[model samples]
Structure formats: structure tokens, C-alpha cells
Target: MNTHAMVMALALLISSAHLHAQDTVVIDGAVTDRHGKAVPLCDVIFNPSGFIADDSLYFKCDANGRYRAEIPAGHYNSLYSLDLPQYAKTQLEFWGWNLQLTENQTIDIAFDTIEVYSLAVWASNGGSQSLFAAFRPMHLAAAKLPRLYYKNVDGTPKAIMDISPTLTKSDIQASIDGEPVVLIDFHWSYEHAGQCSAGKDSPFSENEPCYMPMIIAQFHKPKLAPGKHLLRVRIQDHLSKEIGEGVTHFSSNSMGLGF
Candidate 1:
């Protein structure tokens, strides 16, 4: 072969090897609940970021909630799973952000079933000095609630909000800056599914109507000295009588803040 052609061939081979190295990495892990119980039959979604392609990836777990996959090395926004029939979903917590996965690693995910996994408190309006807080009452689906079942257009049983659980103002006990505060408005926030696909054999449907639940409440900010303040929240399931609580510290300047 000519000298110029031989050099070109060697350069091509080196470029191919570099691309291959950047595209292959083994990730294996198990999804478990707060008590270390397997959260079976769910797909873990990895959302990519930055200059990488917008296509997301899914890792299907076995009935034992264990998964292993080969994915491209890149920066990712977060990894999370959708709600299962028997368990409430988890998101954005404990999952690393701006994650750079470049080598083989084990990443275990834990869902907060029957506990308060995370809490965030922030100032809603600076002028009004009103504060807002939200928390996940993990494993909320386990609570007893009356279900109104109906068939879908395809004759499949449609998922309905009738089975969705809720908490009243009486169910939450919150305190800010060591003083009692009333949770005036109580509501639920949901994260809908989009542009993600699950394995055909997986029990979780990407199009399922039900999703994870979050409890949000608002309280009037007390007149405190401008500094860091403590907010404590306790939540209870009216049906199961289970309780979950979390604490967070925020500053007086914590407008639109979250923890």
C-alpha cells in the first residue's frame, strides 16, 4: 500500500477504537425501597443532557428489581423510575445530577416507601412572606382507598383517580422557626410520563394514567430575624396510620428555594 494510504488507515483504526471506548460502559444495580425490599418490575430511565443526543434510555429490571445494561458514556440529568401498581414512584432525589458515567459501575436506587423520603421548603412570595413546602409520602398506594374500576376503549381496565389517595389539612403537622404554622392549601402534584418507553415484558406501562404523588402545602411566613430558619414537617396516612416526617433549614432570603 502507498505510504499516504497506510497512514490514513492507521488513523481510521485509532478513531474507531476511541469511539468504541466512549460508547460502551456496563451499569448494574438493584432498585429497593426504604427497608431494602425489592421494588420489582420497573424500568429505570436515564435522561441524557448537554451535547449528547436527546434520546433517553431505559434499563429494565427483573422481578427482583435488578438490572444491568451497556450505555454510552456521557453526562446525564437524572435517573428515575415510574410508579408501579403497588408502589409509589420516586424522582430527582438521591439520583445524582450532572452525572458523568464513563466506566463500569453499580448504581442502586432506593424508593421511600412508607416514609418521607425528601422535603423542600421555600418562600413563595417575597412581598407576602408566604412559604411553601412539599414532601413525598412514599408508598402512598399501599393505603386503603375505594376504587371505581371501569374498562377502557380497548376493554382494558382504565386507571382512574378514584383509587388515588389524598391527605387533608388535618393530616400534616408543620412548624417553622419553632412555632406552629397552619397548612392552608393542600394539593397533590403529579409527574406525567412522556417520550419514555418501557420493556414489553415489564409490568409498568409508560402510558399508565397513575403517577407519583407529592403533597404541597402553604403557610404564612412568620416575622423572624433574617437568617437561617428550620422547617419541620410530619405527615400521616389516614388509612394505614403510618407516619413520615422530614426537616429542612432555609434562609429568610430563600425565595423560590428548595432543598
Candidate 2:
């Protein structure tokens, strides 16, 4: 081969080798609360910040909120699924630091805890329909609120609201006599000046204290008969903070509420 041709061929081979090395990077990360407590079962989602609309990469934290995912070596916006329906949307920002995934990188995500002010269950509208409940969360000021948007739903909006809290990343469950009961739906709202607005509607006025509303888990089966029933409620925040809890006597005729 001629000298000039040999030099060009060698340069091309080196460039190709570098490109191949760039494509083999992996990402390892751990999800934890701000206090260093592990956040288990949290979804770790990777969104490409580039023009290419690639499908988001999804992974989950283990029982200790640790996760590992192999990445294709690119810049991405890491998002953690930290469920905080009661705080202002801005205050609930769960995005991690921007990630530039190179060769076998490691990133750690830390989230703060959410506050649960109160929790209660009641029979609204004369109890003809299923049961309803309310959980009041601590509100965030406007400057720190997150943006709220709408998404499509499959069934009745009421049912969707009732079931949301049950599906939270935290372990939230209600059972009777060691038997599990189906939570039909989940709902949430925001409270300001004694008036509550649906969470989906955002941009609250900055004049008053606005709080994220609590999740109300509804029950349609294993009827809450008119007698003594032990009601237990527990809630943990992103940082493993037990922000809300309740253990009280419930009766069909009582306005069920315990802090």
C-alpha cells in the first residue's frame, strides 16, 4: 500500500475503535432519601435530553431502594418516582442531577420526605355510594410549587382518584381481620382558605397557605358495618419519615378520624 493510504486507514481504524468504546458504557445508581435512608420500590427513569425521542429507560430500586441499569452511553435526565401528592408540584421536584453517562458511571439520587397532616374516612352524600376518605398533606408556597397537568383516564374519574394512593410507591394497605380488602379508588385535592381545589388544577394564588391534599382510599366491599372496627393507617415519606399514622376505633355511625 502507498504511505498516504496506509496513514488514512490507520486513523479510520482508531476513530472506529473510539466510537465502539463510547457505546459500551453502563450506569449504576442508588436511590435514597435525603437522610440517607434507602427508598425502596422507587422507579428510576432515564429520559434523553437530546433531540432523539427514545423510549425512556425504566428500572426499580430494590427493597433498600438501590438500582442498577445498563445504559447506551449518552446524556440523560434522571427522574425518580417520589410520590408526594400533598405538597405543591414545584416542591415535589424529583429529578436528579443531569447525567452524562460515559464508561460505567455511578450516580446517586436523594429525595426529601413529604408531609401528611391529617387522615380521615367518612361517608359522604348519605353513604348511598361507596365510602370516601381524605388525607391532608402539608402545602407548599407558590414559588416552589410543581406544575400540574392532566392525563387520560380509562374509567370513572372517581374510581381513579380512589385507587391512586393504594398504588403509591410507599407501602399503604388496609386489611380487615388479617384479610386484604380491595381499595376501589383514590382521590386528592388541594386546600386553600377553607376551599379545596382539585390537584390537577394548579397555579394557586400565593397569598394563602396552600397544601397538597391527602389521598382518600375508598372501599366498596367487606362492608364497613355498624360496629367496632379497628382502623389502621400508616404513611412513610421519601426519606423514610413516618409523616402520617392512625390507629382508631371505627364505627359505621362514627366520623372516622384519628391523627
Candidate 3:
């Protein structure tokens, strides 16, 4: 063969050899604590968002802080993520590469520990609402947090039948269709930086000011039909002497509290 033809023949030989070597693919990863400690009870998914062992990109992490899922020899752009729902947190994960890999190839991954804090608030009415809250002496950051998530007696959250920032007995008793049995569930992101003071030449005017605190509640409930409703928020800031008192009214629709 001529020199050019010889080179073409050599290229074909290399391609043929590579095609026969790939067989099974391996998924490798480690489950570590915040301190790099290996975590047990971890499972990984091998789906399109996971691995290729099952054609889909999903699989579970095996014990020993390791994961290995086999896939056919080919290129795949699967997505991967952990399955932690109760808190609805999922994003950081260890699989689903955007590149191509051959069978029997091993892919390694590592993940960080996830953490969260929980606060429970009971519901009651004495023509108003009541609850206890506390904030200790610690440094606070500046960020908005999810304060509250309201739910129903069946653990289902209900929308505000009506909101009376300035709630009265008559307003509480009135109902749009009949009456709304709704309750407020409280939640918080716990990033406190609620302090801001404008120094000389501050852009803020006398009325516009900055405020930050430990607990700001958000109420996300099922949407209810239109009607008047009474909404109250009881807070307790143990560390802050000024706000550690009775349950305060955070908002209402009647008086257009949060309109």
C-alpha cells in the first residue's frame, strides 16, 4: 500500500481494537460527613439522572460509601441527584456526566452532608393567637428566611378564608361560603442579619429603614375561595428582651396588613 493508504489502514486497526475492550461501566463515589467521615445507609440511583445500568439515569448509593452502576458502552448525558424529600432538598449529587464513557469504565464521585433545623408551632385562638419564640445572643447574617408553612388538621394546609390584620370577633365569625378552618404552619431559613443603620449621607430617608430578626414566618397553604379571615403570628425571642413578649400580630388581610 502507498504511504497514505498505510496510515489509513493503521487508523482502522486502532479503532477496531478499542471497540472490543469496553464491557461494563462502574460508578464510584464516597459518602462523607461534613468532616469527610464516610457515611453509611447511603443509596445511589443509576438512571438517566443516575447511572446506565438500567438504561434510565437513576440509581441508589450502595453501603461502604461507594456506588457502581453498569451501563452499555455509549455516550450519555444523564442527570443525578439525591432523593431527600421530606424537606424537599435535592440538587447536589454524584452522577450523570455530560461526557462520554465506555463500558467497564469507573466513574468516581463525592458529596457533602446536608443539614436543617426544625421548629414546631401549635395553633389555637383566644379571639387571637398565641405562641412562644426565642433568639439567643449570636451573630446574625443578612438573608430572607422562609418563616412559616401552614397546614390543615389532616396535616393539609388551608388557604386564608379571610385575613384581618386588625381582627375582630365579628370578622373572625364571618365566613365567605360557610367558615374556613385554616391553620398556619411556621417555617424559617434561620439566616439573621436584621440590623442596618444608615450613617451620615445614608440614602435612606427618615421613614425608610432596614430591619432584620431571627424568625420571619412564611405562610404557604392551599388556596381557598375568597372570604374574610383572621391571621396572627405569635413569636418569642428569648435572647432579644424587646421582642420576647406575647404573640404579636404579624399580618392580616382585613386591615390590609401584607397587601
Candidate 4:
């Protein structure tokens, strides 16, 4: 855990604590893999955007990978993550999205195998913090993604810090049907340097860009045959010296979205 990482995480946690008392919108959804298999007990984190101040919302999926989140009516972003220590780190998948929540909504998110993986370190307390995301494509070129899911050693909910700059195209590689594709064009997003920008540059530096700590990438539903198609993600992080590589098999029904 790096001291700067812990400081940054704490700062983001403090800033996301601004609670609002007003009408709220309810979000109900399921967390499933690309194959429509439920990912139970996963964590879903929500942070509404475009508000004077915002609070972080947390939810947990049941055995069927179903969860409900209540948040103020506003534009919001959510991250879905499942931490199954039993599986290889490279096998884990995480997902995130940005959307408006003016009323009750039902958004189902899907999970894809991890192509690249990263973690932030809290040097002050020696804790490793990371956000992992996965995605499954839908019929209308849309997707089902998971929310940010992480907990403290004390079993308390933790907010994810914006650190998206640490990841680059070079760190990830993907191929569809053996045809290489652009990494940046697939589900990549950054956090703005706002109130969450504190401690992003240096431990106590005043000027620095604060991007969200999570890295999101996805493969949209591509037109393929009705048989098995291969989706591969090769990840190499120069900074962490950690490599994540895996292959996922997806199937299509000619006209339907395949996982």
C-alpha cells in the first residue's frame, strides 16, 4: 500500500459523504456474466453526478446477483464488482457506467472476463485498493455492467478513488475473431478533477489532476456466427509489473446478442 494511495482514497471517501434530503430514484438490476449466469453477493456502488454535493450509495447482490440502489434524482455513475478470492485475479470482471436517473430505472449489467487489472495502494495503512469491471453485450448494442464493489479490512464500504490515467492503451490489448481492435474506444472513461481531485498528484500537493481510480473496458455485441467465438484480453501494467491474460468464449444466436 502506498501512502499517497491511502490519502487519496480517504479524501474521496470524505468528499462523497454529502447527503441530500429530497426525492430519490430507485435502481433495480441483476449482475450476470456474459452467459447470463448470476454473480451472487457482488457489490454495487453508486455516486450521483451534477449535484451541489453527493453521497455514495452501496448495495449487495443476493444469491441471484440481484440488487437495488436508492439515489437522489440526478445524473449518476455506478460500478459493479465481485471479489471472489477463490478465483484467479485475472478471471475477475468489473463494470461501470454513466447515466441520468431522473426516475426509477431497471438496468441489468453483465460481466466479461478481465483483460487488464489494476490496484491502488494505501501507503499509510498498507492497504491495496482496486476497482474491477466486467461487461456483457445486449441486443441493441447496449450492455449489462456491474457496479464498483470493494470493502475495507473492517468490512465497511469504501469509495473508489479516480485514477484512470494510470491505465493506457498499451496496457491492454483485445481481439475480436482474431481481428485486433482499438483498446481506447471500448468503454474507457475518466473522472474530472473536481472535489475528488484532492491528493491526486502528490500526498499533499494542491495542483493535480484527479481521475477516477477505476478502469472500464467492454466489447459490444459484434455480429458473429452462431458457434463459439473467442474474445481475448492481454493486460500488462508497467508500473505494477502485474500481468493479466485470459480468453473468454462467447456464443451468438445469429440475431441475438451473445456473451
Candidate 5:
């Protein structure tokens, strides 16, 4: 072979090697919370949009909130998964807990959530009764709040509400503790509100925006403001800040709030 041809062949080989090194590859990543820490025990599952369900295996985040999983081998062009709890859609609390892994790479995820502040709740008429009202968790607001439902005895808990823009909200159904319930749809709010009832036609039209006037009506919230007293526990989310003055009653004998 000619020397010139040999040189050209060597150049081609070098270029091919470089291209191979730069080729895209699958990936594995460790997911953690905002504190740059590890998640100890959260499950991570790959979405089936890329492949068969059995091929998709879930991983758990460790105590430090750190999780690791291999990218599945399949026809997937590229995909990823993070180890975290399923999303809470309300108020943006727990929506983005997971991460996606690209093919042939490692990722370090630092997830963050909105934090809330608060002060002690005091009612003018009551003697600082903190044993009744329950504070909602941040995840609850962050998650997709399923509207309770019961149609046939076997079709109960269908979670009938679908707030997506495409789904019409003209009619809604609810139930509590094996009984029928109703709520009023909101004009511009992400969530529906209304009074809960056990019988038929609501006081207002079924198409009205609201049915249960107060959020506490059918919730069995065990309110302490206007009544005598009842033992209840309130849990506050770190994300909902200062939970307002009279909104949530804290849990346990501890009122430190610790914020």
C-alpha cells in the first residue's frame, strides 16, 4: 500500500475512535432532597411509556434520601427515573420529587419544596383550644386531590374529579365514610369547594360553583372554635408557611411549632 493511503487510514481510525467515545450512552443517577443529602427509603419507578411494565423496576431512596437505579436496557431512546413519593399536585407542594436518567450517564438530583412559616392560632371566643382542628400536610396540597365518589356499591372511590382543562367540571360527586357527598366547583380555583350532604338534590343547583360553603362542613374536621370541645390532632406542612392564625390546630402536647 502507498504511504499516503496508510496515513489516511490511520487518520480515519483515530476519528472513528473519537466519535465512539462521544457517542450517547445510558445513565444511572442518585436522587436526593434539597439539602444535598441522601433519601433513605423512597421508591423510584420507571414509566412504562418507554417499555414493558415488567421491565420497569422500582428503587427505594435510603434514609438519607438518596437513591440509585440502573437505566433499563430496551428500545427506549433515552429515559430516567427518580426515587421519591408520588406527586401531590395541590399548591405545588410535592409535584417534582423525582428525576429522569439519560442513557449512559450519572445524575445528582437536588429536589426542593416550598417552605411555610406560622404562628400560634388564637380564637376570640374559645380558650385557645388547640386539640380539635387538624392541619393539612404539605404533600396533601401538593398532590392531586381526588374528589371522593361512590356510584354503585362496587364502583365507590372512583376519585371522580378530573380538574384538567379538557375535562368539564359541570358535575361533581363526593362521599364520606360510606355516604354520599357533594362539593361546589370553583370559577377560577384549582380545587372545588362545597357543603357535604347525604341526601339528594343539593340546596343549590348541581351546576353551581359551590355546594359546601365551608371546607369543614362534611370533612368531620372536628372544629374547636364555635363548639364545646373534641380531641383532634392537626398536622402542618412545612411548605404552607405560617398556616394562617386560625387555620390549623397543631398536634400533640407540643406547641413549640419549631417552624
Candidate 6:
């Protein structure tokens, strides 16, 4: 191609790039706690709808819990806030789903609601962590004893249990469609130990048992007709006298599969 033609091609490429940049929208917001104070250094993630799990946009809020980013305008399957401080006490980490971003907008996050995170049912016997999904369906025949996993944003289970000796399995309550579901066992486990540690004078000893966030409850799977069902779980912290609850919908089919 001639020099002029090459120059024109370059110009066209630049123009296209400019137009693509214009297609982006700015997203800004602040993360606050129940006391209306900023939650600093919180992580925000936006997962594009119907995309791979690794495909996501991440941003971190400033010291005042304010965040801003320019991203391509599109729909998101989920928006999550992670790595929140214990003082936040948010019940849910997943803030929004099926979100559409067409223009610049401000989306503030707050932790005033509840105190649990990642509350969901697992289809396995709770022996291995591989079978865990935030919303995995429960197969009644395969997993007659499905387990519930959740985390307390306020403090670790061991710490709470230390303060409240009376805390027991009865503190956790579950129901399906407003019907009580019998719980068989309750236990606590760490979700991610590598990211947790104890400091000198910390309530934890030697930081040996840190990061025990996951509270598991095993229950008998009830028979259900094919369709959607609502599962509700309520937890009361005996030490703080605070209550946190979570609700999720699962589908049951003839094959005893939960969706």
C-alpha cells in the first residue's frame, strides 16, 4: 500500500479506538457501615453476565470507602463486595445481580443490614470443600444431609463461642417454605486460613485457629414437588444479641436434583 493509504488506515484505527473509549461508563460509589461511616479499602467486583468465572472487573474503594472506575457499558451477572472489615457486619456479600449498566451511575454499598456472608446450601456431605457452590442445587438422594455454610462478618465463630458458652446448634434455625427443617449437626471451619492471623494480645491464641468464618449446619433434605422453594436461615449471636438471616431459592425436580 502507498504511504497515504497507510496513513489513512492509521487514522481510521485511532478513530475506532476513540469511539470505543467513548462507549465506557463511569461507576462510582461509597461503601458505608451501619453507623453511616465509610468502610475503607473494600473490594468491588463486577462479573459480566454469562461470562466465564475469571472474567470480571475489580476495583477498590479509597480510605473513605469511595470507588470510581470507567468500564464498558454492559450487563453484569453479579456485583460483589469482599474483604470487608469485621466492623461492617453485613449479612450478604453479593450486593446485586442481573445489573445493567448503561450510563454513569453511583452505587453505594452499606453494611447495616445483617451479619452473615455466603450463606448457601451444599449438595455434599460436608466432608470436602470441592462440592461447595453459593447456590448449588441439592440432590435429595445423593445428598440426604445437605449442609448450610455461612460466615459471620462481625467476628469468628471461635471468638463468639468463647464469649457465649451457651451458643449451640439451636442458635441456627432453618425453614423451607415456612416449614421448620430439622438440623442434625452444627460445626465451624475456616474458609481461608492463609489470609488470617493473630496479633500479640489478640483474643486468639497463637493465631493457631484463625479465620474460622464458615459455620456449617447439616439438615435432612425434605421431599418436595418440582418447582421453586424458598430456604431461610436465621442465626442469633448469643454474645452480641444480634440476629442475621439469609434467604435463597432453589428448584427441586423429580430426579431429586436441586437447582
Whole-model lDDT, model 5: 0.32
Per-candidate Cα lDDT values, in order, are 0.59, 0.49, 0.33, 0.47, 0.32, 0.56
Model 1 Cα lDDT, one tens digit per residue, 142-167: 43432323334345554333323346
User: Every model's Cα RMSD, please?
Assistant: 12.7, 21.0, 23.4, 21.4, 19.6, 12.8
Better of 1 and 5 by lDDT: 1
Question: Model 6 off-target regions past 4 Å?
Answer: 1-114, 124-166, 197-210
Best by TM-score: 1
Which candidate, 1 or 4, would have the higher lDDT against the true structure?
Answer: 1
Write one digit per residue (lDDT tens) for candidate 6, span 1-259. 9999999999999999988876898988777654567878878887785432777888998988898978888766656664556333333343444455656776656543343444566545334221122321111121222222233654744331111112467766777777888777776554543322345444544434434335667776767667655566655555444444444445567844565
- Candidates by TM-score, descending order: 1, 6, 4, 2, 3, 5
**Top candidate when judged by lDDT against the true structure:** 1
Ranking by lDDT: 1, 6, 2, 4, 3, 5
Residues forming the 10-long window of minimal summed lDDT in candidate 4 = 137-146
After TM-score superposition, the amount by which residue 248's alpha carbon in candidate 2 deviates from its true location, in angstroms, is 45
Q: How accurate is candidate 6 locally (lDDT)?
A: 0.56
What is the overall TM-score of model 4 with all chains considered together? 0.36
Q: Using Cα atoms with residue i matched to residue i, what is each candidate's TM-score against the true structure?
A: 0.42, 0.35, 0.30, 0.36, 0.30, 0.41
> Candidate 4 at 179: error in angstroms?
22
Residue 112 alpha-carbon offset, candidate 2, angstroms: 2.5
Query: In model 6, what lDDT does residue 189 have?
Result: 53
Per-residue lDDT over 1-259 for candidate 4, one digit per residue giving the tens place of the 0 to 100 score: 7999999998887666533323677878777765568978877666554222256666788988898887777655434455455233433545343444666767665544432332211111122221123432111111122122233424643333422223455766666456765543335444332432234343322433333334456433334567544454555444543434333334445643443
Stretches of candidate 4 exceeding 4 Å from the true structure: 1-22, 49-54, 84-93, 115-259
